[model samples]
Target: MSSSGLVQIDGLSPIRKEDRKTSKVMLLFPPEWVPTAPYLALPALTSVLREAGHTVVQRDINIEMYDHFFTMEFLIWVKGRLGMQLKPLQDKEKAGRLTEQEAAQKAVLEEAYAVDVFDLAQRSEDAKLIVRGERFYDAEKLERALNTFREAMQYISAAYYPASLVFYPMESNLGYRPGVSKEVFACLDDEQVNVYRDICNQLVLPSVSKEKPTVIGISIGTQMQLMAGLTFCKMIKESFPDIHVVVGGNVVTRLQEEWAKHERFFTEVFDAAILYEGEHALLWYIEAVNGQRPMESVPNLMYHASGAVQQSKEVYTEKTAALPLPDFEGLPLDHYFVPERIIPYLATRGCYWGRCTFCDHGQGYFDQYRGMTAQHVVEQVTALRDKYQCRHFLFSDESYPPALFKKVSQLLVDRNVGIKWTTLIRFEETLQDQAVWDLAAKAGCCTLYYGMESANERVLNLMDKHAKKSVIQNNLHQAAKAGIWNHVMAFYGFPGETRDEALETRQFVIENQPVIHSVELFYFVAYRHTPMVRNPDKFGITIHKQEEYDLPLDYYYTLNEPVGISCLDAMQLCEEFYKNDFSPWAVRVNSREHVFLYISKFGTNKLPQIYAATKDGATTAEGVSGLVTWPMAIGEGDEGKEGMSRVVSHGVG
Candidate 1:
């Protein structure tokens, strides 16, 4: 290995011409992620491989699956699958051996069978068109289209009964706990509830067969993608034993240690895994497979060899400036559920403010922070704009640094990039100036997502966020004043946060509704690698580990002392806040892309049509309360149009 852990076998003699030849590679992004845009990982890796003279075909299976789900042909096929499922259950019921669960599955299939598949499929197709056309701007029509999608998802769920699959939020449960290795393995082969198996058969395998790529790389970025990504790996390995299967992404990086212990994952599911930054590592691995380099020299790689799993000794980090712009060429951009293409661009690799005790996002990167210059950012933004004709961008940074934020905003304006954008940012004292916000808005900043974990200063300090209440308020006010939509995300509990402190956060958001256009409140999760979980006593919490959860990424925890809100209490508090105070944030359109597009369309933060209609037929404005929202609850005696209008809306923050 070289000093930097890059493969150093160029001087070595090649074994054979076939072994030394360049290989065709296929990169697959698995499902259960938001299908609004192409994830940056595939394109980022694809650019490197293609630049290296290898033929690369990148597939966004997540968006492809969603696109296929609402089609007439796919829905008709789902109807047949549902009938097949019903037959087995009906046979069991007739034999008087059906269990309660089986009977419930039978009922689901029966109800699904009763629906007119042809009519449902037509509506489903129309739903797809509405989201991808001018009708998306009509909130009412878009809402109905979204409802049709949910109905189609419900119909498909019957085929894979007990597996809850959703569209917008990209949540899917395959009736198996993903954290446990045994269950995860069992889920891969399960013909009943593992919906991904059918998805692989219909979508992934045929593509693999046609492309016949020598190597396949699957990116599993989130926990939700784990089951689906792994299923794709296993199925592809089974069908094409000669093809090399590799997995990588944020989730893989976080669980690298645990994955080392699971020998079957390397031997059966995937041939190798990449950790941390994957660009250089993957290129090195491909060279190794072609016999031009030794496998051990590939940095950030782990593979099964000689009856054991081994990780490369030295880890390599990417030079942010050296990497090429993400290649979005092969992805089906128009298939995404947006009227216009919205590209996701990353200028920074890791969090600059990396001290938050609750965050494990930093663990995904070997280096905590590396960012490109403001001029470089604007240059690439313009390049992407010209190449893809996409004017909306999602700056998928961990947190936009205040200095870089100001510089980039000014550069965008100076260069006249003319692209609408949104990104997550921290509330910085340096960003108190109104000119910064105005410049950002003028540079086409449509929205900003703030990780304002708590409004209480003491709670913020406990989390090591150190953001002042004054700064938070000032940031929101200025951003709003500049016509930018501010979406604030805060959690209910930290280890030592009291009930009153949690209430303080709730009250702060309620009082600042005019400035905070949207809100998301979550209960704290003790990720296994978070600073708080690592030093439990220091954070006044005791981490709980379950033996069966061998592949665990997070853990349950308890307060070390009886002085703060317990985990259960945090959950209850979040529920209470959603029930009582979520009215103002419950929007007709919940997807971030949709909201960003709306803000860009209206050219203002105040969108009355986007809000839920009040019981008195008024739009629920900021500071409004007790109004029925999109996901309104149904009362015992309520029915018909009035009841439907009273339902509250639920969506991502």
Candidate 2:
């Protein structure tokens, strides 16, 4: 791939869409999408696909689509359409049930699921609402809405199309962090949008060539994953109609229920939708499309054919070791902005403490705490480093328990590969062990992102996130001493968060400033599949829903006592972020598991001197807010000539 993301060599199109019997797949990520990551169906899906002896392509579109002119205008428009509140599918006993919670969830489902008939009419003029998102959705209408969005974006600004990868030019300049986040796409100007649109459109239609493989596979890791998939499917359908397009990842499963309803979209854009982990599923799709295997037994597959949608048998429980280590070689290894791969490795899936009431990951015993052989992990690392010469890695594992850390501590030391890495580790003194610390530092573990959920005891219990504040603090101090960058994820605005407790969070940050490198604050949004969403009524929490999309603030909780701030105070919270150059991070601890000694700060611009100033100290919060405008929005102009001096850039990469 050229540094410009344009193939300087002639006719480097991907594998053709024919010869479906061969094991080839194209994974796609969507453009200008939201969500840090999506439909994380990859780890499992990739394994499923690979298990079937098929080639899989991982498309990192979450970062890719942002390369386009993803204007704040689009975001604001989406916000206006979806509203600021979330519809967590709560208050119902089941996901689709219509009990009180279900009723509320249903109300939202009705709205979001349905195409804005008026908008559709406005866009298409004569096109009828083929699939209504009403109680009885016509599959035809669903297709129309999707086609409409696609057509609109394609036509309005498809000319400038050169920036398919937003960071393509500035990639090497980035530090060890991941690609510019979705948030970075905000405040896009007309010039940036036109350039980005042109670049993206250019990549959309790959010129066919002999080098084009028979089939291509793309992986959707974030919302952009979906967007990328959307474009790839369309492009392939238009350019290489014979190629079978297959799609799968985590997000697909969550919305499978809705997606399953929209058959026309799949029939037109893709051949199959693999909702389950596809390590083996890709093979199934290949075999099925290529006449290699039967679909009856292909677990977790959604296919559209003969004007009907066919879903394969569902399979959940699978052995971790049985899965492949993930094929990272095919990716542009050197293209990784991080010096090292920032390799998102995981020791295992599933949290041992999978009792978080609000986490979708806790459902169906999906993420049961399971450990991989430390050797197996090291072996993968060895392979990546030897092949890609990666010097740093970032473990994307949601949790790395003490035992797993202890078990690998020595192996990493002895293996002597001398790589640096970071993982999401629980707050435990075990990390303080000299051997562990020494090995980690030597192994390239420079930072640890710890999740100290909250300072509110009641909220912790409610969320089932057990961590004592005292222990968390101690862990941070020890981690700081251990020479690790301690970025703590402190959450506020959960149930039972009193103003006093909220203030306590601030106090903790101020007091532990030296120990903690950075802090992050978050308002709780009940995950789609978590117990909080499953049984919201039992806890007296109500969630409002919106159609089309959701955001962080859209989710809110009601407690016996209103703690911290309600959703209504979301602005006040903004007031805090905008007024202070403090870079808007949070910190927390509770009675359950502690997650101190680490934190991940979102990289923003450097605010004015927050250390010496206050909202009113020789300035108003408005004056200090890096975002000069309303609601702390860091406008595009804020990012000045070389790199804005205002947006705080300090963060854990």
**Candidate 2 worst ten-residue window by lDDT:** 636-645
- For 1-653, candidate 2 gives per-residue lDDT tens digits of 32312211111112334633445554544443321122233434555565555666655444344322233334234333333222443333355554564455345434543434345336433221221113112223433443443443433222222122221111111111112223222312223223332333445445223224445544433232343455456556666777766665444555556566666557666667665344555655566566555665565567775678877544434456766655554444433212123344655665555555655532222224676888888887777667656555555565567776766656777888666666666665445555565555555556666656666556667667776677677777766666666665554555446666766766777677677655555445544555665576766567655442422212334554443466445445635743463433221110000111111111211222222233554433222211212232111110110011011111000
Candidate 2: list runs displaced more than 4 Å. Answer: 1-21, 29-200, 207-216, 316-318, 339-341, 362-367, 429-439, 546-564, 581-653
- Model 1 residue-pair collision total: 7
Overlapping backbone residue pairs in candidate 2 total 104
lDDT of 1 by residue, 420-528 (tens): 9988788999999999999999999998878787899998998888999999999999999999999777777788899999999999999999899887777787877
TM-score of every model? 0.92, 0.63
Per-model lDDT: 0.81, 0.45
Tell me, by TM-score, which candidate is best: 1
RMSD value for candidate 1: 6.6
Model 2 CA lDDT for position 387: 64
